[model samples]
Target: MKEKWESYPSSIRLLAIAAIIFSTGMACIWPLVTIYIHDYLGKPLTVAGFLLLLNQGAFLIGSVAGGMLFDRWGKMRTIILSSAGIIAMSTSLGFTDDFTLYTIFFLLNGLFYGTLSPVINALAVVLWPEGGRKGLNMIYVAQNAGVAAGSALGGVLASVSFAWTFFGNAITQVIVLVLFAVMLPRYVKSLALKPQSPEMPAQEAGKAEMLLSQPAPAKKVVWGALLMLCAGLLISWIVYVQWTTVLSAYMQSLGISLRQYSFLWTINGGLILFGQPLIAWVISRFARTLKAQMLLGSYVFVLSMLILSQTTSYTGFVAAMFVMTLGEMLVWPAVPAVAAEYTPEGQEGFIQGLVSGTGSAGRMLGPLLGAFIFQTFQAEGLLYIMAGLALLSVLFFALHSSFQKGSHRVPVQTAEKL
Candidate 1:
C-alpha cells in the first residue's frame, strides 16, 4: 500500500492535502455563521442570509479570478497568496465579536477561499490528466474528510464559544500555509523544464482521435448538455446550501441544540468521505455513463428534500441528511468531471471556473431565498421550497440526459469518415 501510494505524483498528494486543510477550516466557519448571527449577535435571519449572499457573491468573483490566476501565476503562487489571505481573514474573524467587522471579514474570507478552491482542483487536473473522473472523486473524498473533521470540531467548540471555531480555523490554515511554503515551490521547480514521457504522446493522440471522431451534431448536443448540466447543478447547489443556512435554524427550532446541528453536518461529511469511493465503484461497474450516474443521484436529491419537509425530530432530520449525503456523493464530483470531459486544450482552468461560478451563484441565491421563505412562510414553507428546487434540478438534468443520448449515436458514414 505504501509503495502504491508513493507511486502517485507529488502534486496529486499536495493538492489533496491542501484541499483537506482548506476545506476543514472553511467547514468550521460556514455552519457557525448563521447560528452565530441569529443566536449570538441577535440579528434577524434575513441579515444572516444577506451576509452570506455578500460572501458568496464575492466568492463567485473570486472563483472566476482564481481560474485566470491559476492559469497565469501557476500553482505555487496561487496557493500561497490565497492561503495568506485566508490567514488574515481568519485572524480577524477570531476577534470579531462586532457584526459589521465579522461581515466584512467573512466576505473577504469567502473571496480568498474561493480563489483557493479552483487552484487545488486545477492542480489536480494538471497532475492527473489521465486519471479521469476517478481521480476527481479521490480528491473529493479528501475534501469531505476535512469537512468531517472540521464539523465535529466546530460543534464541540461552538458549545464552548464560537470564537474558538474562528481561532481554530486560522490555526489550521496557518499550518497549511507553512507546509505549502516549505514544500510546494521545490516540488514545482523539480517538475520545471522536464520533457514529456514517451507514453504520454500515445495517450494524447488517442484523446484527440476520440474528440475528432465525434459528429458535429454530437458536439453541439454535448454543448447543450453542458449548459443543462450547469443549470441543474445550480439548482442542486441552492438546495444543498440550505444545509448550512435555513436548515440549521429550522432544525434548531425543534429543540435541537447547536451541537446536534453541527453533528448533522459532521454526518454529511462522513458519508461523503467514505461513500464517494464506493459510489465511484458502483458508477464504474453499473451506471456506465457520467450522465446516468448524475441523473440517478438527482432523483435521490428530490427524495431527500421531500423527506426533509416532513421531518419533526432529530432522528428524522438525520434520516433525511443521510439520503441527501447519498445524493451528494453521487453528484458533486461528477459535475466537475463532466465539465472536464468537454474542456478544450489551453482552457482547462477557465472551463472549471465556469462550473465553480455556477455553483457559487446558486449558493449566493440560497441563503437569501431560504431566509425569505423561512421567515415569511415559516418551516413548512421552506420544506416545500426545498422540494421544488430539487424537482427543478431534476428537470434540467433530465434534459441534459436527453441530449446526451443524441450525442451517443454516431452515423456509420461518420465513423468511417473518422
Candidate 2:
C-alpha cells in the first residue's frame, strides 16, 4: 500500500500540494477581510455581516454550477478556469474601497472559489482509486492543514494591512495556476491509459451522453444527506462564525484587546492543524462506521458549545474551542466520504456540489444567526440555540439510519416471500 502511494505520479502530487497552498492563501484572507470591512473600511457590523452572507450565497450557486460543469467538461478544465477567476477576484479585492463593489467582487470570488472543493476531492479519488476511505482521510488532512495555516496567518496579517493579506492570497493563486498549467498535461497523460469502463452500445451511449448533457436531477441521496448535514452544520457554524463577529465584542466585554481577538483565531487554527491529521488517523483505525462517528461527534460538539456558554475566561473559551475541534476532525472528513458512498456512479461531481452547497448554506446562515442571537440574549443564548440544533441533528441522523436499514432489508424480505 505504501509503495502504491509512493509511486503516484510526481505531477499529480505537485498539483495536490499546489492546491493545498492555494487554499491556504484563500482561507487566510477570510477573517482579515471581515476585520478590514469592520475596522479599516468603517463599515457597519450589519454591512459586514451582509457581505459575509453574500459570499456564501454566491458560493452555493457556484458550487452547483461548477459541479455540473466539471461533470460535463472534466475536472482539469474546471479547476484551471476557476483558479483564473479566483486570481482576478482576489487581486481586485485589494484595490477596491467601496463596500458595494467589495461585496460584488467577493460574490464573484465565491462563484469561482466554490469549484475548488469538489474538483479537488474528485481528483484525489481518481488519483487513489483503490485507497477508498484512507484516501479520503488524506485529502481531508491536506484540506484542513491548508485551512489551519490560512486562518492563523490571516489573523496575524489582518493586524498589518488587509491589502497585504489580499495581495498575499493573489500571489499564491498565481503560483498554483502556473504550476497547474505546467504539470497538468503530464498528469492527464499518465492517467489516460487506465482501462476505460466498458462502453455502452451506440444507441445507449447516445442516450447516456444526452442525459449527462442535460441538467442534473434535483433528487439524489447525496442531496438528501446534504440537507440533513446542513441542519447540523448551520448550528455549529453559528457558533464558529461568532469568532468573526460578536466574539470580538465578547472579548472586549472581558477587557481583551484586538490583538487578543486575533490571537484567539490563531489559536483556533493552530489547534485544528495539529488535531485534524491525528483525528483522521484515529478515526481510520477505530470508527469504521461513518454514521457512528458523526453521531458521537455531534454529541461532543454540542457539549463543547454548552461548555462555551459557561466560559468566563480566555482559557475556558480556548478549551471549548479545543473540544469543538475534536468533534470537527471526526465529522468533517466523514461527511464527504459518506456523501460519496451514497452517490451513484458517474455523478461524483454532482454529489460533491451538493455537499459544498450544503456547507455554503450553513456558512451563509451562520453570521446572521450569531448576530441575531447575540443581540437578542447575548452569547449564552447562542450556545443554547446551537445545543438545541445539535440535539435535533441527533434525532434526524437516527431516523436516517433507521430508514437506510429498512430500505436495505426490504429486498431480502421480498426475496423470501418469492
Q: Please provide, for model 2 over 305-363, each residue's C-alpha lDDT reduced to its tens digit, 9 standing for 90 to 100.
A: 78878887878777777777777776666666666655544456766776677778877
Which ten residues in a row are the worst by lDDT in model 2? 409-418
Q: Each candidate's TM vs. the true structure?
A: 0.79, 0.80
Write one digit per residue (lDDT tens) for candidate 1, span 1-418. Answer: 4674576677777767877887788889876788899999899977887788788888888888887776666656777778888889988988878888888899899999888777666656655666667677768888888877777788888888888888889888888887767766665555443444556678797885686676455367667877898899998988888887788877777889988986787788777755655676768786677777787777788788888777788898899899888888888888887777655433456657777888999988887788888889988888787888888887887787666654532222211000
Query: Whole-model Cα lDDT per candidate?
Result: 0.76, 0.68
Among all windows of ten consecutive residues in candidate 1, which has the lowest summed lDDT?
A: 409-418
Candidate 2 residue pairs that clash: 28-150
In model 1, the runs with Cα more than 4 Å from the true position are 1-8, 35-45, 95-98, 154-164, 181-225, 248-263, 309-315, 371-385, 401-418
Candidates in order: C-alpha RMSD to true structure: 6.4, 7.4
